[model samples]
Target: MMLMAAVLQAAVVQPAPGMLVERRLAEAIPLAVGDTVRVRALAGSAQPRPFVVAGVFEREADPNRIARNDYEVRLHLPDLEALLPTHDRVDRFAIVLAPGARADPAARWIESVAFGTRAYGSAALAEETSATFRVVSRFHDAIGIVTILASAIFLLCVMVIRVDERKRDMGTLRLIGVSRGTVFRAVVLEAIGIAVVGSVAGAGLGVVVTRIVNAHYARVYDTTLRFALVTPRIVLIAALLGLALGTIAGVLAAWRLVRVAPQKLGER
Candidate 1:
């Protein structure tokens, strides 16, 4: 799946010499527009021939986006047909929709026939491209959840031990007029402190583990897998989970202390 994502990201197309329509002339030839050059027509001619460089045109003006242009050359369609013997097969066709165009009928028809097209809108393409990354992201979230769950269980056990060891101390405090609320607050604060420390350490460990996996797998497979793509939202979510888990563990551990007999602890 990772390999598929990489390939899809890398896939690019360029125009051939014989093709009449090309998106960008800048990409087709090394020289600027109006620069004359010799080229053999792949479709119309039997041999290499000379041709003039027509004026260049821009296809799309979005500087940040990939440019898909329509190159106007001096060759006719018949010339293209004559150059290639296998003219029976058309490799690709470009179509543009009118403003507010709808292809629902065509789409329904295609679906009824159990077929699909590669043509998609920019938004659709973006969604499809991001889907792979989303899957990988969810996998990372699963790892975080597992870490938090394990930490919660361990902290609960530790709280249980501390409660047992400090029972006498707590009893004395209670006798001296330390309210149950104060004792509860102290225990909760301590648990939160432990959770915060453990969570920070766990985050650092996660980064190291991710780096090691990415480096080892990339070296073995000769592929790039980026593991440092952390976002603020993801980090925030992880932190909240850790905090909530910690609170739950603290509550469980404090339950027994809160339920102690007032008389037995000399609170009367």
Candidate 2:
């Protein structure tokens, strides 16, 4: 399942021409300036209240406004207050710190005036988000481990079968006075070549698939949560891992073939 908390945190908000509507929402409902939109004042309200679309904005003014749904709309403070049941009370407030200003004193002052009010910094939000997705992160790690192990096992099986089929060729090399180490090196290099090709192809396909999936997610959720990111470091790691697996499998197969007498291998 896609993690919603991460998506909400990464969403970008920017200044808009007028009142802002999410990009996806604007596309779905085609609103223009001076147009009127109805919103439900309260649950089970018989009639929806109409508000003028002063402007339709795609960007957000505040980053803290966590909107998970695509059908989101923003309005001016006064207009929003006018629709609420209690004009005096607000759900939350955000304060921006100026340069050279301290946060502790301001937080203390705000708490003293308003009971039950809590102040948090950007770091707190990051900590909370990480905690929320800890399990998901662990699951992803487990999947990576399983994939590596499966790849190693599959390569081992294929190399073993290939060595069996080429027994006569190995015997011929041995009869021609080729050193065991040289024969083993040749087999390992061949396996590495095949593995490198396959790994590179797989990585390319993975990158394309990841981009398509991420685009679909943005279109559907209107959020910027990337499912997969293929970076240079990731590519390097994959390539190294593929080479290691191939080397291990090839060594095992070559060892088994070399242990048998050349005369016996030739007879088989």
Span of ten consecutive residues with least summed lDDT in model 2: 61-70
lDDT of 1 by residue, 1-268 (tens): 9999888777853333332333345564655645555555455546654444454544433322222223445465655565565665554444566778776665455357533434555567567667656887799789967866787788899988887788878888887888988888788777887877776776778677878887875565333435354466756666777777777877887777867964564433
TM-score of model number 1 = 0.52
Q: What local lDDT does model 1 show for residue 24? A: 47
In order, candidate lDDTs are 0.64, 0.77
Question: Pick by TM-score: which candidate is best?
Answer: 2
Pairs with backbone N, CA or C atoms under 3 Å apart (clashes), candidate 2:
13-60, 14-60
TM-score result, candidate 2: 0.76
User: Which residue pairs collide in model 1, if any?
Assistant: 23-69, 43-83, 44-83
The number of clashing residue pairs in each candidate reads 3, 2
Which candidate leads in lDDT? 2
TM-scores, one per candidate: 0.52, 0.76
